[model samples]
Target: MNNPYNLVRKYDIMLKDFQTISTSFLVKQLPTATLFVDMKLRVVYASDKLISLFCDEKVNFVGQSLFTIFPELDSKWETVLKECLTGKSSPMGVQSFTDAEGKEKFYEWSNASWYDSDENIIGAIIQINDISLAIESDVALDKANILLKQQSELSKIGIWEYDLQKKTVYWCAMTKTIHEVALDYVPDIDKAIDFYKKGHSRNAISMAVFEATDKGRPWSLKLQIVTAKGNEKWVLAAGKPIFEKGKIARIMGTFQDINEEVVAEIKTKDNAKLLKTLIDHLPLNVFIKDRDSKKILVNKSECDYLGVANANELIGKTDFDVYPFETAKLSRDEDLQILETLKPILGKESISVKKDGSETVFLSSKIPLLDEDGHATGIVGISLDISDLKQKEQELRNLINVTSLQNKKLINFAHIVSHNLRSHSANFSMLLDFLVHEKDEEEKVKIVNMLTQASDNLLETLENLNEVVTLSTNTQAKKEKVNLHTKISEIQQNLSEIIQNNKLKIINKVSQNIDIRIVPAYLDSILMNFITNGVKYKHPDREPQLEFSTEVIKDYTVLSISDNGIGIDLEKYGSKLFGMYKTFHTNKDSRGIGLYITKNQVEAMHGKIEVESELGEGTKFKVFFK
Candidate 1:
C-alpha cells in the first residue's frame, strides 16, 4: 500500500532505527549471557558480561572461532554452533568446562538461529547462564535421595504421592512392597484405594484423602490391607496436603507395616477377657492387692460379703480402710508374713468386720503374685467364712465335756458296786462249799455253773467299758513324726501269720519319704485292724488282695487300704459302718468291734477315715492323718 518512493524511504529509515535500539537494549539488559556468532562459529557480538566471563582483555574476539577461545569444548562447540546456524533448535543441560586460566565453571546453554526480514537463517544467537551452584545442589539432592531410599528399605517404610488435580498416584519401591505389588505395577487413585480392605479400611482411606484434597486437612490412621495373594496386613498411614494458590495440589504420605504389633494387641485383649471371666466365676471370695496393700480387684462374692455397692468402690482401698482396727491389723500382719516368706500363707485365721459392724470369722489363704521377672509384685487371696460352723463346734465341745465328767463319776460308782458283789459272791461260795458237802450233788453243780457264768459276764463288761473310755480320750498329745513305710512294714511283720493263713496278696506302693504325725501305737493298731478285717471278710471265690499306699493331701498324708474281696452294701450300712457293735456279716468272730475301735483311734489322733464300697466289687478305706 506504500507506493510513493519518499514514504517508503522514510518507513525503511524508521524500521532501521527501531531495530538498532531494540538490539542494543536487549544486549545490555538481558538476564542471560547473550552472544552473536558468525558462520565460522566465531564470537561476532557479545554482551559486556559475556566478554568479561570468556576474555579478560578488552580486545574484540570477532574473528576467533569458539573452539580457539575454549579449546576444551572443540568438537562439541562446533557441532552445537552448526546445528543452530542451520536453523535448528538446540537445548543442553548444565555442563562444566575450564576457562583460559584453567578455573572450572558450570553453564547452561540454549541456541536458536537468527533470521533476517527475508526469513533466511543468518547466524546464531546463543543464551548462556552460570549454573555452578545449581548443578552442585542437584548432585547433592540426588545423593540424599539415594540415602533416603536405602533407609526406607531397611525400616520397611513406604512413601507415596497422589496428585489431586490429575487423579494420579505415584509410589516408591518400598511402597509397592508394602502393598505386596510388583515393582512394575502402575497404580491410579482408584486402584490404590482398592488395595485397602473392602470395608472400614477402604472407606476410611477414601474419606481421609478426600478431606486432604478438598479441605487441606492432614490425616494419620492405622488401616488394614488385603494383598494380591489374599494375605491381610496392618499398616500405619500418614499424609499431608500440598497446596498451590490456596488450593490442594497433591497428597503425600508414608506407610509402615504394623501387622505383628496389631496381632499381639488383639491377643492380649482376648487373654484379658478370659482371665476376667475366670475371676468372676470362681467360688471362693477372691481379691487382688497391689504392692502397697491397696485392693485392685475384688470379685462379686467379696464385694457382696463386704456390703459394698460395687467393685470399683473397693479399689484403692486397703483392708485397714474398710475393716475394723482389730480385724485389719490381723489381716495386715498375715499379709506381711506372706511378703516376708515370698511363699503362700495358708489357713490363717481372720475375722472380717462387715458394714453393719458384725464380725465374721473365715479361714484365709494368701499367695504371692509374681511379676515378669519372677519377683513378688502383689498378692492374691481367698477367704472361706466359717463363723457358723465354729459356733456349733464350740457348743458340741461343751456338751461333750459335761458328758465325760458325768461318765467318769458313773464309772467310779460301778467299780465300787463290783467290789461289793465280789465280796458277797465269795461269801456265798463258802457257804455253798459247806452245803455241797452235805447236800445233793446235782444242786451243788447247778449253783457252781451259775456263779461261773456270772463272773465271766462281769469281767467282759468291764473290759469293754475300759476300751471305750480309752478310745474317747485324746491321743494326739503323744503324736510324733514317724515314717509311714517303716511303721507299715512292722505291722506287716506282726500280721505275717494271718496273711499267710489267709493267702492274702498285699501290694504296697508306699514311698519311704511319706512322713506323718500320729501316735505310733495307734498307727500300728489301725493298720492291724484293717488287715484282719480284709482277711476275715475274704470272699469264698477269691483270695484277699490288699493294696496299701500313701499320698499327701492338702495338709496331711492319707493312708489308703483297698481290698479285692467281698464288699459291703454302703447304701444300707453307710452311716453305721463304724458304729459300736454293728456287725455286717454273720460269723462266729463277727464282733464288729474292730472297725469301731479303728474309727475311735483315728479320730483321737486328729484324723479321719472314709470308705467306698460296692456290693461285690471291692472296698477302699482312706485314713487321713496330720
Candidate 2:
C-alpha cells in the first residue's frame, strides 16, 4: 500500500514535470472509475472512485497487482492490458465479478495506453463504468410495458397521440377496433371528431380536445360515438397535452368502450322510477323501517294517514316523531319483536286514540326484510284503515239489541270479515311489491291477473258480510256424521293442481270406515287451510308431503294432519301461532289468518285444535271432535 500521489510519482517519472498535486486531484475527483496500470499489470495510480467502487478500503490497492484486487476477472484481462501496453488500444469490454455478499455485478472497461511528451508508451489508463443499475432499470421497464399493454387490451382502452409538428395522428390497435375501422385506416383529427355522435357527444369531445390542446389541460368525458358500422356506443374519452417550449405540441389520450356499464345504469334508473310509482299508488298505508326502527321509506297512503304533506316528510322518522308517546312505544315494541325474530306480525288489530279521544282502528302487518344471509335488515309494514268495518259492527250490535242469536251471527260475520280482509290485504301488498320490481312483462301480467282475482274475492267477502248480517235466527245449526276418508279425498281432489305442481304426496291414512261428527263446511274449511299450508311452506330441498290420519281416544275422535315443511318455532311463536294475523314464516303467500280462522271455526263446532311443530322439521295439527 502507498499514498496515491507518491505512488504515481514513483512509478512514472514522466509526470515529474507535471503538477503532481493537480494530477492526483484530477484523478481522485474523476467521476468515472479509472486506474493507471504499468506494463507489469499492476495498479500504479488508482482514482478514489475506482478504489471505493472495486477495491477494499483498508487495503490500499495503488501499488497492488490488478489481478490481486479483482481475481474473479478472467484471463482475458491480461490480454486487454498487454495490448494496451503495445500501443494498440483495447475496445470496451465487459467483466463480471462476485462481491463479498455473493452478488454478481457488471462493469464496462476500455483501455488506452498513456504516453510522455516524447510519445513513449508508459501505462494504460482504464475507464470502467458500473452498468448493473441501468440493466435492472431496463428489465423493469420491459415488464411494466408488457403489463400495460395487456391491461389496455383487456379493458378495451385505445391509446392515441396527435403530433402537432407532423400534423399526424397515431391510433393503437384497440382504438381502431373501437372505431369499427380497418387496422390500416388512417385517422385525421377531423375524422376522429366525426366518429362522435353529431349532437351532445360531438360537442363534448370537441370541447374536451380544445381545452387539452390549446390550454395544456387534461380532460375526461363520457360521451357517445357512432362507429363506422353505424352502431351507437358509449365511451369514456380522456386526453392530456404534451408541451414543448411552454406551448402545447401534442395530445395523447385514451378511448374506452363503456357501453355495457352506461346501458345498465340507465336501465336501473328506469326500474327504480317504475317501482317508486307502483309503491306510491298502493291503496294501503305502507312504510319500511330500518333495523333501528327509523322509517326509511313511506308510500303516499302512509304519509296521508300520518298527516304529512308528502312521503319525504316521513322518511327517516320513527313513530315517536309523529305519534303520541304511548302509541309510538306500542308500535316500536311490535317492530322490535319482528326484527329480533325475523318473523312477520301479520293482520294484528291495533287501536290508536287520537287527540280528540276518538279511536282509529288499523289492521297492521309487519314483515321482516331480510338480506341474502337471512338476517333481518329492516321491516316492511302495511296498515289498513278498518275504522269503517268497526263502525258497521257496532251498528249491527246496536240494532240487534244484544240478543243471543243475533250476537252469535254477528260474531261469525265478524270473524269472516276479519279473516277475509286480512288475507286479501296481505296478498295485495306482496303482489304489488312483486309487480313493481318485476322486469319481465309476462310475470307482471300474471301478477296483475292475481291482483284482479284477489280484488274479486275481497268484493265477494264484502257482499257476504251484508248477507250474513240478515240471516234469520231460525236457521238451524247442526253437525252431521261425515265420512272422514271421503272428506279428505274430496279436499285433496280440489287441491289437485297444487299437489301436482309441488309434487306433494297427500297420504290419506284415515280409515274409510271412520266417521267424524262435524259441520260439513267447517270440516272442508279446516282441511283446506291445513292442506294448503302444508304445500305453501314445504321445504325447498324435499318433495312436499302431507299425511292425514285419524284415531279415537276416549270419547273424542281426532284427525291429525302432518307435513314435511318449514315449521314454526314453538318456543318463540307458539303463543301467537293461532292468533289472528300472526305469521311466523317467510312464505310470500302467508297472511297469518288461516290458522286463526281455522281454530275459530273448530271451536264454533265444539272441537279443539292443537299444533306441534319444530323449525325446519315440520308441523302437525290435531283436531279433536266430541
Name every residue pair that clashes in candidate 1. Answer: none
Tell me the tens digit of each residue's lDDT in model 1 across 448-498. 776677677557646765776676655435888888888878888889999
- Candidate 2 regions off by >4 Å? 1-31, 62-68, 71-111, 116-123, 130-140, 163-166, 207-219, 240-250, 330-347, 352-360, 367-377, 389-626
Please provide, for model 2 over 524-555, each residue's C-alpha lDDT reduced to its tens digit, 9 standing for 90 to 100.
98899998898899998999899999888887
Summed backbone clashes in each candidate are 0, 1
List per-prediction Cα lDDT, in the order shown: 0.82, 0.84
If scored against the real structure, what TM-score would every candidate get? 0.42, 0.53
Which numbered prediction scores highest in TM-score against the true structure?
2
Kindly provide the TM-score of model 2 when superposed on the true structure, using C-alpha atoms: 0.53
lDDT of 1 at 14: 100
TM-score of 1: 0.42
Local lDDT at 214 for model 2: 75
Angstrom error of the Cα, residue 223, model 1: value is: 3.2
